[model samples]
Target: MTETHATNPPGAPVFPPGRYGRRREPGRRRPLVPVVLAVLLLAALGLGAVRLYTQYGDPAYDAQVITYTDITDSQVVIDFRVTVPAGGSAVCLLRARSSDSAEVGHEEVTVTARPGERQVTARHRLATSERPFIGEVLRCRAPA
Candidate 1:
């Protein structure tokens, strides 16, 4: 009979050819947490840009004279109403223009209202014949 050496080096593991005794099952499929987070981040960035444009970039200057009483050569006192969407506010800019549509004077005012109807008063000067128009900027919340 041939001699069979029965010696396994320390800390060394040997396994049969067809089976690794421990039978390692397929690893569990990990959840796609990282992918989900990346998608959410991209979506948030898009939404934030939209909000910024609506709030600061696009201001629908809506000027209405509630009361145009005090009138003078240098200044005119006129009470006006400012309207904006609920859950936000509007900043009114009184733009004074020259007869040739040149901006000569501009005054900014802030008005906040709930998610409904809000009425605010503003007074501006009629520096020139370029009739005054109201500019309303809707300030809203950004994406989380």
Candidate 2:
């Protein structure tokens, strides 16, 4: 018995004409489109970041919680420091949370720096309905 082999043409395999619809040719590459889109996306993100920082972030008024003590069922004492523009004042938002991370109390306190003073330490006793596990200074802003 003799073995025979079937030879096919080189290049893409041929299919029944029109059975799979028209074969699409490779399209032109538009490298510029992706580059342009990436540039626009970055520009949009930069603008958004700048807008948010201007609207919500302030370096002139900053607060840090030095310690949280005197935790009790009714209150927590939060000792914090606020840095404000020299001789300026700030309104800070303080918060107390229970062990489960639930906000139990929140308050706004005003801190003032005397002439030539840039930092002021403040202590606030926040009243809560339940026992608080931690306290913090949420944010500080120039008084309106």
Candidate 3:
């Protein structure tokens, strides 16, 4: 006969074999909350990166002044060069206006210089009294 302690409740079995042991379901795991959170975080980061690229990391138009000369009779000549990132064409313009708000002139030219240094010459004639201390616009553009 086996010896037994007498603490069992009325009508209960004397010893329960697996009562105090922990049981695990091997194939049943927790839901993938952390994995879903990680994926959402990465997607947000990717969208932010794309927005930054479109907002601030884009290229702009490029140009420079090579030489400028003021001629007799209030005529000014300007030489400039421009470099385009992709396309290879440019246009030059000389704008002349009077200080007294009397006269205005816009001169346009075709520029065909290579990426480094192309020579463009533009001429403007202004009235002697209307020579602007605040001069005109010199614009360059990719050939359209």
Candidate 4:
């Protein structure tokens, strides 16, 4: 008696027709998508950083609080120094806070630097509705 056997190719194993669903070929990915997306993300981040720096970061009009004294139930005296360009002026925001971090008072003060002067010291008396625990110079900007 003689016996017969079936042979298959070296590639993927063959399945019986209709027994399994049709197979699909691997699809190609486009490399441009990720590059475009990354460029867009970076551009957005750069724009945001530039806007923030322009709005809040001015090295020429920097301000620092030197001392806070003459504290009372209804007022506080804030002594601060502002660094401005020579012969320039700056507008500073002053704030007073209570012991609980509540805003007791706020005011905007303008300081001017004389000729050949880059730093100017200013003192402001801020009025409040309640007692203040601290006085601070929030920020300074070039005068408009």
Candidate 5:
């Protein structure tokens, strides 16, 4: 006759085991959809930024001084041509400068192009404070 003690038998296994339980389900993996969407979103934002910079960073209208005359002691007449998008009104800033490049006069003139015409010719007479040695267009733009 034999008695079994609290301790395991010498030949008995210390613990019963087969496969350990997983910390998480192996079939349930990290989703890849969110990562792909994040990348696509970033790419789209970058393209939009590039497009905006290219569109607004540069001047849109083209201008040239066709001719100028009637340069009096305190006045000047300027004739210029502007090429811009049709159907929109544009504002042209004119400046009269002395031989030393000092501003003697300034004027903001507005012009409206025909519905299908992008080029327009204009002649304007501006008042000045002194005799202007040079009169030209400072800048032109479509009102926002």
Candidate 6:
């Protein structure tokens, strides 16, 4: 067996200044690549989310007013078009508005088509309570 000796000198501290009694500092700086990559990844995901919504998440039906005529004191005629999904039905709210923005007439029109037909066009004659300035299809939706 080798001879054993006391590890620390009697008049000196058990450890040196840099061991545990001094402030700790980083030896080498951490690389910035990981943080930058994380930020870029988050940005890419956010952009993808927005793109997905705009591309595939929008409401599909859009109603277009083709013509409106015969605006009498008690009636209005409107022609409009709407698109529908296969085997789907839509209820459109038709309205006639006066010059002062008062709603003079209102009705719900149901539109449907064969499974392969993607669109439907219709003419509506709304009976109004007073003279109206415009006839419009306010909104259309799929029925439950």
Model 2, range 80-134, lDDT digits (tens) per residue?
9999988889999999999999999999999888999999999999999899999
Q: Compared with the true structure, what per-residue lDDT tens digits does model 1 show for residues 71-108? A: 44444455677654444576665554444555645556
Runs of candidate 1 with Cα error greater than 4 angstroms are 1-63, 98-102, 114-116, 124-144
TM-score of each predicted structure versus truth: 0.35, 0.61, 0.39, 0.61, 0.63, 0.63
- Residue 115 lDDT in candidate 3: 50
- Candidate 6 lDDT score relative to the true structure: 0.84
Query: Candidate 3, residues 9-119: lDDT per residue as tens digits?
Result: 567545444565643433678769999999999999999999998887634335565554574446555555555444345665555555566544556666554555434
State the lDDT of candidate 4 residue by residue for 21-138, as single tens digits: 7655557867998999999999999999999998878656788999999999999999999999888899999999999999999999999989999999999999988999999999
> What's the distance in Å from true for residue 137, model 6?
1.6
By summed lDDT, which 10 consecutive residues of candidate 5 come out lowest?
16-25
Report, for all candidates in order, the number of backbone clashes. 8, 0, 0, 0, 0, 0
- Cα-based RMSD of candidate 1: 11.2
Model 6, 1-144: lDDT tens digits are: 332337544664344444466543437888799999999999999999999998877457768899999989999999999988765678899999999999999999998866888788889899999999999999998765
Cα-based lDDT at residue 28, candidate 5 = 57
**Residue-level lDDT for 55 in candidate 4:** 88
Error of 1 at 42 (Å): 21
